[model samples]
Target: MKILLSTLAFISLAVLLGLLTGGRLSWLVRNTTALRLAWLAPLALIFQWVFFELPGMDRHDLVFAGHLLTYALILPFIWANRRMPGMPVLAAGLGLNLLVILLNGGMPVDPGLLRAIGRVGVYQDLASRGWSGNAVALTDRTLLPFLGDWLVLPEPFPARGPYSVGDLLIYAGGFWLLAGLTRRPAETEAPLKPA
Candidate 1:
């Protein structure tokens, strides 16, 4: 959720910057028309279905399966569109995240990091109930610990959160993808128009 929000925020900043620099906002939409981004729909739809009725889900394993499927699905989409701008960076982020999740059985969010955001109790409650999306109770056995949500954003933001390096790559890729739309190639003088 935070990843999506932060990506959107960056893309919004790109739009604002584009407009300020005499670029038409419409240009971004027009250029993005060529991208086959519908490949990402399942990722969104599965999550929407999960989070909408988050209280009813009793098994983390099922949630984990959905993620596995979604991330696995991204590979073919990326391969087909590898030539597109920003796709490679986006693929790198997705690959890192998928590798971590597969190795850890889920996202291995540290409890202390959750505590910093005042979200530890909520995760604790979920654990008591028999399920949790993350908050893996960080331990010696936890795999790929560095790839988890290890970076902290302390007090004074709209939300207190820990983000992963993969999130940063995704944000950068999304920003460049949109920002590239506003750029127009330099015009050359038309053979010095004879007077």
Candidate 2:
């Protein structure tokens, strides 16, 4: 929930920055018209929400599979929009996140990092739950620990919590994408055709 809120906050900032830079909302809409397979992103989110939020669904493997499937569903959308401004960066972020998640079988959140961020309740929950949603408790056994959720934003800040490097990249790319929409491209690509 915190992660989602943080993402939303970043998105809001992106929109504000865009408007402040004279980027019209209509331009964003027009720019998005070139996006293909965009619905898949939302579908991926729905898939995760359904599986991760299911009551009595404590099976780790199932949740893990659902998490992977969510990525699978999103990959096509990203690929389809690869040419869009800031998309390559977003893809890089997505790739890093997917790589870490694949290696660890889920996103890992370090308890110590959580405590440092003053999210001790989350750390305690992870300790009791073994895994929460798509995040597994970070352990020494965790592969690519550096890529895990250890980056912290302490209190007295909105959207304060642990964030991965990939998360930072994702937010940055999102900001660029939204802000970039202010500038009209030289030429628009044709809509993708059935292959």
**Global lDDT of each model?**
0.61, 0.78
> TM-scores of the models, in the given order?
0.76, 0.84
Off by over 4 Å in 2: 1-6, 116-121, 187-195
Clash tally for model 2: 0
Tens digit per residue, CA lDDT, model 2, 68-154: 998899999888877767778888998999999999878899877776767676577688976777788999899999998877675
**Top lDDT hit:** 2
Find the candidate with the highest TM-score and give its number: 2
Residue 135 of model 2 has an lDDT of 84
State the weakest 10-residue window (summed lDDT) of model 1: 186-195
Instruction: Please give the distance, in angstroms, between residue 127's alpha carbon in candidate 1 and its true position after superposition.
Output: 5.9
Clash pairs (backbone) in predicted model 2: none
